[model samples]
Target: MLYIFDLGNVIVDIDFNRVMGVWSDLSRVPLANLQNSFVMGEAFHRHERGQITDEEFAAAVCDEMGMALSFDQFAAGWQAVFVALRPEVIAVMKQLREKGHRVVVLSNTNRLHTNFWPGEYPEIAEAADKIYLSQEMGTRKPEPEIYLKLLQEEGTPADRAIFFDDNADNIKGAQQVGITSILVTGKETIPAYFANNPC
Candidate 1:
């Protein structure tokens, strides 16, 4: 059996509010406005898909935020989002691997975020057998193409694997691909699932 996990809130805790606070301080844009205005649309998706450079995405976001800031300033706020690693989740991944199950990470994330965390928490790289990142894959979650691509690459049939993700859309997307997926609500969800299901 294969155990697939999502990186962002599932394995590593993150706070978007921290990002908004950092940007608000630097850009003088109200946190509310930034939170409401920052749409995760094509530009962001493209960046995660490795179709745009960091500066390119930063410029687009800066323009949208009405901020007179350089890419460096924008990236500072972006890098501040990671809060900590989720040890409970990592322990489960390790346990599953010890049980002879393949464990991997599939994340819908941009290069900047991906690049930042591995350095801060080296355990993230060690927790999974392989990490499927959207920036390298050229596609992201809630999309059939990305999930299909992953299934094909892993050579594992959908029914043989279980996926854990924090996003409801991604969970439905995995279900569409015929993969069993669990929606992770909080720190306890993963542990709770394993406790109840024993897998």
Candidate 2:
């Protein structure tokens, strides 16, 4: 059987709220208001795609929040907020591979994150059979097209394939495309699923 997994939040813990909290203190803005303006909007997406540089996005965020800070200061502080992997999750992926499952990673990360991945986590780079990064593909999750691309590339029947992701919408998208789906909740549950539901 083939298994597809989400890279961030599922495999690694990513607290965007914590990053925003740091930005809030530096920019002297309230978290609730800043999130409404930038978090839900396309400011981050545009920045990730290089449509706007990090400095430009920081400036825009500052302008919207009615505060000021140097680009270097904001970038350095934000980069520091990202955390490392939980080793238990890495062990789970390695065990799945040992059982002969084709394990792949799918993430909606940008160039900056992808470039630093190998340095941050060598195990993921070495163990994953394949990786489908949205930045390179120009697509993101909850989009049927991206999942369809994975299904096509893996050449696995929908019934024999399973996907584990944190986002409910992405899980639904995988199910809609006929792939078996699991919402990532615990590291132990996945291996247990394979043992009982082997293909």
Clash statistics: count for each candidate: 0, 0
- Per-residue CA lDDT of candidate 1, range 17-114, in tens? 89889999998888899998888888999999999999999999888878878788888999998998999999999999899899999998887887
Give the C-alpha lDDT of model 1.
0.90
Give a tens-digit lDDT track for model 2, residues 1-199. Answer: 8888888766777766776787778877788876676543466656544466656777776777665678765665466545777566677777779988898998876555665666777888666899888766666677787888888888877898878887888899889989888987665656666578664
Give candidate 2 regions above 4 Å deviation: 35-38, 45-69, 186-199
Winning model by TM-score: 1
Q: Clashes in model 2: which pairs?
A: none
TM-score of 1: 0.97
Query: What TM-score should be assigned to candidate 2?
Result: 0.80
| Root-mean-square deviation per candidate | 0.9, 2.9
Model number with the top lDDT: 1
Question: What is the C-alpha local distance difference test score of each model?
Answer: 0.90, 0.73
